[model samples]
Target: MTTLYLLGSAAPPVLEISQVIEDAQGRGYDVCLGLTPSAARWLAPQLAELERLTGHPVRSEYKAPMTADVWPRADVALFAPATFNSINSWAMGFTSSFVVGYAAEAIGKRIPLVAMPCVNAAYAQHRALDRSIAELRGMGVTVLYGPGGFEPNQPGEYRAEGYPWGLALDVVGAMVSPTT
Candidate 1:
């Protein structure tokens, strides 16, 4: 099975993560989820349910080095609703959490990485976001942003509209199976 690392950050769309997981599964991917600490807290009520969806525990904190990794090696990675912190931290190689650690590693490990940020318009204007996007793109991570991917919503208000969840999955699908 083609394993996909579905990494989530503390963003508005973390609430709808299960739908994305199911979407990935529908595309024949074996999904593995890792969330930032804050995201984990937000999804606390759904962790067990998420495990059932992926058949693996959702990992947030770093396990001891000696501990066995329950999830398989990822063939590709998707950082959905990737927050401003995650993008900056990942580009700067900050790995305080499991998701960021895995994301940081994916660049060098040469596992295809795709990211879609869900930052608000004001925050998206930060210099760090531009630099981070450029840096990650320079390293071959597929950033789903700009005009097509994630348009920043106004501050204090996320879209009451649905997120384009399938766009990320479509990008990953194309990456994983180009001929398809």
Candidate 2:
């Protein structure tokens, strides 16, 4: 089975990750969940259930050196509902959280990567976001922003139900498809 590292940030859409995981699994992926530290804290109550659903420990922090890995090696990584901070940090190569760290290293490892941001319109206007998106793209990550992916909504008009998990999964499907 292709192991997909389904990573997320603390956006409102992160709350619906269980359904996203199920959707990825249904599409023929062995999903492993990773989240930013803040996202892990936000989903603390459901951590165990998430672990059970993926059959792997949800990771938020870096493990100690020489420690063995808990999840299968990732065949691909999809970071969704990526927040403004997470996007910037990742582009800047600040690997403070396990999710960003793994993603940064994945680029060097040449692992196929995809990301979709969930910034509000106000946050999306920040110059840093554009630079970060471009930087990740330059590094060969398939960042699904703008048309056909998550579009920024008005500040405080956040709707978690509107996140584009299916679109991200579709891209993942193509990446993992044998024909591709």
Candidate 3:
């Protein structure tokens, strides 16, 4: 089976995460979602709905050691609605959250990966975000940013139509081509 790890952050676009799952599945991926702690809280009300869509758990916390893994091992991973905080933290090797933790290790595991940032223009201006993006790209993660991917909106002007969930999914499909 072609399994995908769909990771989300607590960005505004996370409210419409079902689309991300839908896109992944449409591209023939068996979706498994992981949320940052804040994202898990934000998406709490829709946890069951998300589970229904992915047909798997929406994991936030680390599974207890020695427990059988609930989701299939990832053939590819996509991190969307990737917040400024999550990106910076992951780049700095902070694995406090399941998504970041997996991403940190996925690089070494050679898992095909994609990341789509949901930062606004104001936050995008931060030097640290640039550093983080650069670092992730340097590590061979396909970061979908700038034109044709994700573009920062003006702060406070987030429109759901503007998020690039589709772009992230498309990149995933390409990465997994002839993949299984």
Candidate 4:
């Protein structure tokens, strides 16, 4: 089974991550979910939903040293609806939380990682965010979505809400496509 890691962020798009996991499972991939603390507050239902869909617990944080071993090796790691905080934290090498920690660990292992950042226009336009994006890119992370041009204000809503199927398909294609 192809192991796909779904990293969460503090945005409404994080809730939609369950749909992505369900779609991936339909395409015959096993999905695992990891959520940021703020993202967990916004979409608590996703934890249960993702567990039901993937038959695995949704990992929120690394509570103990041995906890990391329980996770399967990921074929792909995608951070959808990535928050500005998460982007900055990851870029600055902050791994105090589970999501950032796991991301760092995955990168060290050379896992094929992708991030889809979802932020409002103002946050996206921030100079710090821009620099962080550049740093992440320099670290060889594949950013899967567009630049921060659009804004989606409500929780559980997205500026590009209609394109989830396309996003999920893109993730699947990336996982299976051969690298030169």
Better of 2 and 4 by TM-score: 2
Show where candidate 4 strays beyond 4 Å: 145-165, 168-172, 177-180
| Backbone clashes in model 4, listed as residue pairs | none
By TM-score, how accurate is candidate 3?
A: 0.94
Clashing pairs in 1: none
Q: Tens-digit lDDT track for model 4 on 95-179?
A: 8789888777777788878777776666766788878878888888876545332243444444545434346457546566522
Among the numbered candidates, top TM-score falls to 2
Clashes of 1: 0
lDDT of 1 by residue, 1-180 (tens): 899999999987889999899988888999999999999999999999999999999999888888999998889999988999999999999888899898888788899999998889899878999999999999999998889888888888856666778999999988996221
- After best superposition, candidate 4 residue 149: deviation in angstroms? 9.5
The number of the candidate with the highest lDDT is 2
For model 2, state the Cα shift of residue 63 in Å.
Answer: 0.9
Candidate 3 regions with alpha-carbon error over 4 angstroms: 178-180
Comparing 1 and 3 by lDDT, which wins? 1
lDDT score, candidate 4, position 96: 79
Question: All candidates' TM-scores?
Answer: 0.95, 0.96, 0.94, 0.83
lDDT of 4 at 124: 60
**Each model's lDDT:** 0.90, 0.92, 0.89, 0.72
* Candidate 2, number of clashes: 0
State the weakest 10-residue window (summed lDDT) of model 2: 171-180
